[model samples]
Target: MVGRTLTAVAKLSTVPAWVRRPLPAVAGVEDFLLRLYRRTESAEALAGFIALSWLGGEAADGPLLWAAPPEERFARAFLAVADALAEGESYPPPEWWRAEAGCLAPMTEAQWNERAGSWPERFYAHGVVCALGWVLGVFDDPAIMAPLHCGDGRSVGYGPREEWRVRLRACAVPLHLRNEEIAEWLRSGAGSQSGPAAVGAARATPSRSTG
Candidate 1:
């Protein structure tokens, strides 16, 4: 099954770069996440998995799947799987069942924020540790909020309450962008700088691992 999944992934990778360019950067991150899910089988793991998958890489069918919104039962089942795994109990559902019944429900922003907080501290710790790989301007892109909305209201609206806002705040300063540098860049008043430098400092500074 693993081999088959890898084969499928490889086949998908062969598609035109132009076509794939818009897809979320799921390759490296997804692979790591899948292993984590298989091992831990926790709801937070599943949430992260689905969220990342939803965000990464565009397939011909990608938009359609994403269009469904994370409100469906399938999304809920995935979360239940994570919950079961975290508890160290055998999954209560039947072998053929993947997720809990009626798991899929449209999330509100407030709900998403609640779940984000609910995830075991370990996952966020790991996320904060691994967040260094994100490139400059990655968080600045508005699309990053899509998966975060996974049935929650906290993920929407303008300004900082969004998941990206928190992630950018927690991860950006330590990973690539320095606080002083970011402040300077914001204050530069260059009438909107573009490219990498605008997102972060010219020099890449490694941050302490939250792990």
Candidate 2:
């Protein structure tokens, strides 16, 4: 399921080139989050983060643009999926508010920069990796068995908290090795490449269940 999601995201060719670049700047993070929030607003709140990380690969650059013709197209896709899950119920929070709440924490520019610096290049890159891990963790969780089993339902679950923490560590690899080749980096102390394609390729390979 996780591999399928990553493949689906990687197939989106219309995502802007700038959005595809692996820069770790704050602007990049904000842009990615904003676009993700805009598209997934009507969907699950957690979906925004998932959408960003799932679609926004390590190579994505600039603000995330949808492969769909108009922004509404992408928005509708997300809304349809989200609405189906809601089962005729309204989303608890407006999409924008949910995005703002989930993404925007009260951190000063200096703090963001400091954190970004602690990362390989910047915080945006770190966020991208974190977002991916978060998505994977949610998928691996056992509590939300319904979402995994059923196609669409109101019981969409976000997975276990412990799993999320472990996934976060896995996703932080690119951020920690910005200067190195992605394919050559080691994750969980195992050697892997630092390139985006390497990461994508890794997703396709079967490994022991992290859960």
Candidate 3:
């Protein structure tokens, strides 16, 4: 494990080139990338991090552009999903929708209720799941790279949350590595910027259960 991590750390310099935008000077961001890169043994996670970081850097980026503080909304939602997955729980739980409602200030329960029932946030949440699933090999289907259709009324294609939770546990990347990657992402400030890189439309069918 140490050797693999060292190998990943060794290639850290080259990661910047693949990212569409610059990573912020957030504390521990580099360390987070290093750990994620090491455990995943790929630069994809780093690239995703870079892409997702744009949410906090500017408001004009991705689907949440209308979000008052796109970064905060993205970060909160992403962490909710990541942490839930880490603990083997279903994501986008009812509580998550109503969580930190104050971020949008002046937002009442009724407003949160309306927003929570909306689709954009759900798209963001599923997008995070898809990105994580792809990188982790749980959604290793060839169609993963296809363009994502955010509000097209198409299904996520993933079978069920519990099913994937089992697959996540059985994946080549251990549960601890998953936890560590998320922890590092949050600690590095990248997570605070936003959660997992919402790559594109994740339509890949779930890979069969490994357990």
Candidate 4:
């Protein structure tokens, strides 16, 4: 079925056919993801799969999934799928999901005006990701978060402690952080000045992977 709901995903108890239509190259990946869906019916895993479909099989920004409030899981079994998807890794949920989702939720509702001439900078399909569940944000080809600072252009939206491992592609970085540190950094005016320059210097750094 096309354009189904969370309720539908849980009810039908299977990955919708629409998602698997465009996918061809990955042998058995679809079956694996589908089995995982059928077994656990996780909201986050479903959300991640939907986002993967929208990304046209290319790694865009994330494997983002919706993590319902912990309070919601008292009766539901959604987290099981998220756990299975994670295999064994662990990380935290996104910042947006943890709170009441005050402003970020509204941004997802805003008009789809992002454009890049004939190309779309954001995307019309991104609505699906938000609709399935909230996405923290998309990073083109993000670097592993070294400092774990969600500064000007950098951000993180961690999932549950157990499920964090599954959402690593969501750019889960590790670093103990403090609000005061971010405030001081911004107040010092280092964000604007050093952000891009630091990025440039990082690019100039020897390739850790190659070296």
The local lDDT score (0 to 100) that residue 12 gets in candidate 1 is 18
Q: Which candidate is the best by TM-score?
A: 3
Per-residue lDDT of candidate 4, residues 40-156 (tens digit):
444333443444343332322323233222222210122222222223222224453344332222222112121211111112122223322222222221111111212121322
Whole-model alpha-carbon lDDT for candidate 2:
0.33
lDDT of 1 by residue, 1-211 (tens): 0111221121113212322222234334444445544544433334344344433334221111123332323333433433333344432434424335343333344533443454343242223212211222223432332222212222324542254345433432333336567668668965265656655753465677999
Q: Between the candidate structures 3 and 4, which one is better when assessed by lDDT?
A: 3
**TM-score, model 2 to reference:** 0.23
**Alpha-carbon shift of residue 30 in model 3 (angstroms):** 18
Q: Give the TM-scores of the predictions, in the order they appear.
A: 0.26, 0.23, 0.27, 0.21
lDDT of 3 by residue, 1-211 (tens): 0111232231222212323222222212334433444443332333333324333434243222224333444545443443343233332444555673324223345543443454443433344444433433345531332223223434324443334334323433445667899888888887544433432223244657999
Question: What do the candidate models score in CA lDDT, each in turn?
Answer: 0.35, 0.33, 0.37, 0.31
Model 1 stretches astray by more than 4 angstroms:
1-5, 10-28, 31-72, 90-100, 103-211
Instruction: Answer with 1 or 4, whichever has the higher TM-score.
Output: 1
Which digits, one per residue and each the tens of the lDDT, describe model 2 over residues 35-89?
Answer: 4334332122223334443343443321122222223333333333232222422
What's model 3's overall lDDT?
Answer: 0.37
| Residue 11 CA displacement from its true place in model 1, Å | 7.8
Off by over 4 Å in 3: 1-56, 60-78, 81-107, 119-121, 128-150, 156-211
